[model samples]
Target: MEMLIVVAIIAILIAIAIPTFASSLNKARIATDEANIRAGYADVMVNVLLDDNYDAENGNASTAGQTKYYLQKDGSVATTDTNAYKTQGKNDSATTEIAGQKVGAWAKDKKVTYQYDNTKNQAVISFE
Candidate 1:
């Protein structure tokens, strides 16, 4: 009889722990997505600075560069690609890229809701 009771208790514990563990894992995924986005944005900023320097030396009218991880234009980051970035400066259209992969809903809300703050300049990312 005691053995049966022990098994039942273990079963209950497993049931209770599974959902919590799953939820925590989901949260971790969201956190990782946020961090990736922020890193991409930082890369974009750096690319912009580099492009500006290149333009200064080459005397080229075009001052922009785009890749899978960064974008730059006219000495600063470009925020005009809706497919890439959305909602710039709070009132602008969603036209930008985070890490060159196009911003998603989680990145658009500024990570204030179900989303995560993916902006490198405005958000913070930590690892487990």
Candidate 2:
């Protein structure tokens, strides 16, 4: 009877732990996605500065872990993807179309903001 009780307890613990572990893994994925997108934004800025073409769009170099990137063009960004030259929406909005994409704003409602700071000559990707 004691052995059966131990087995039951162990089974219960495993069942509980598995979902929690899965949840944490998902959260980690979201964080990774956010970082990837920010990196993409930085890449675009570097390319723009180096090439002297602010009108061109650049994407993320990451081939895995959610394909998210900023699509910049004409000194403004829209995540539409309709034009292929420029994507429509903001950070969170833009990410929805991309697989495994998670925007701070979309995921946590008040976590993400993407901005272009012309004064600093930088594309500022920040989270709330």
Candidate 3:
């Protein structure tokens, strides 16, 4: 009888722990995604500053007078299209590539979107 009670308590503890662990993991992923978006925006801004005629509307492509930016798995920048960004989260349906580089993985329920505001000369990253 005593052994049965102990087993039941252990089972209850396991059930409680599993969901908490899952939640924490999800939070971590969200934080990472936010950081990636911020970093990518910053890199684009730097490129704009360096070029005298950086046109946000046409700067992301590889054509003449346009700059090429490559997104990697960790959300870092690369000069070439070697390691494009791949989705790492629940939303595998969303496109991981933005402009020319890999953005971070977005969650299915909380989708992430990016756009270049030509009038403001800024990159906007938002979650919806």
Candidate 4:
């Protein structure tokens, strides 16, 4: 029957659309994480400029004299917690690692990772 054929075609169309929609959603989350990393880098630079003796090893920019700066969603300086953006690896290495806790829903247990180079002051974002 024509009705049965039409229903089958509609179902196929929906199946195709579902995957595309999910892919787009995942890409959006990745983009958001990238933006957050860039913002954190900028905040750190600002703190470095403000405090002449800011010590990056202390990891407490808001407390004065610390070189490292943590960023919040509202763009305020965070003194303690860096849960939103987790820093990994060593700054002295060729690549310092940064990670975002909340990844795309489709990524399941995987977290988004970024490799930062202090020499060039650049970050390379990745999902893993």
RMSD each, Å:
11.6, 11.4, 7.0, 8.8
List TM-score per model, in order: 0.46, 0.45, 0.61, 0.54
Best by TM-score: 3
Which lDDT tens digits does candidate 3 get at residues 71-122?
4556665556455554344534345554445554455444333444545556
What digit string (tens of lDDT, one per residue) describes model 2 on residues 12-124?
99999999997777667655555555555655455445443343244322221122223433333333333222222233354442222333344432233244444444445
lDDT of 4 by residue, 1-128 (tens): 99999999999999999999987776666556556666665565565446555446653334333233344555444544444454221122223334433222223333333333344343334434
TM-score, cand. 3 vs. native: 0.61
Give the best candidate by lDDT.
Answer: 3
> Which 10 successive residues of model 4 have the least lDDT summed?
87-96
What range of 10 consecutive residues in model 1 has the weakest lDDT sum? 119-128
| Deviation (Å) of 101 in candidate 4 | 19
Estimate the overall C-alpha local distance difference test score of candidate 2. Answer: 0.45
Better of 1 and 4 by TM-score: 4
- Measured on C-alpha atoms, candidate 4 has an lDDT of 0.48
The C-alpha lDDT values of all candidates are 0.41, 0.45, 0.56, 0.48
Stretches > 4 Å off in candidate 3? 55-70, 78-82, 90-105, 108-115, 126-128
Give the residue spans of candidate 4 off by over 4 A.
Answer: 54-69, 82-128
- Model 1 scores a TM of 0.46
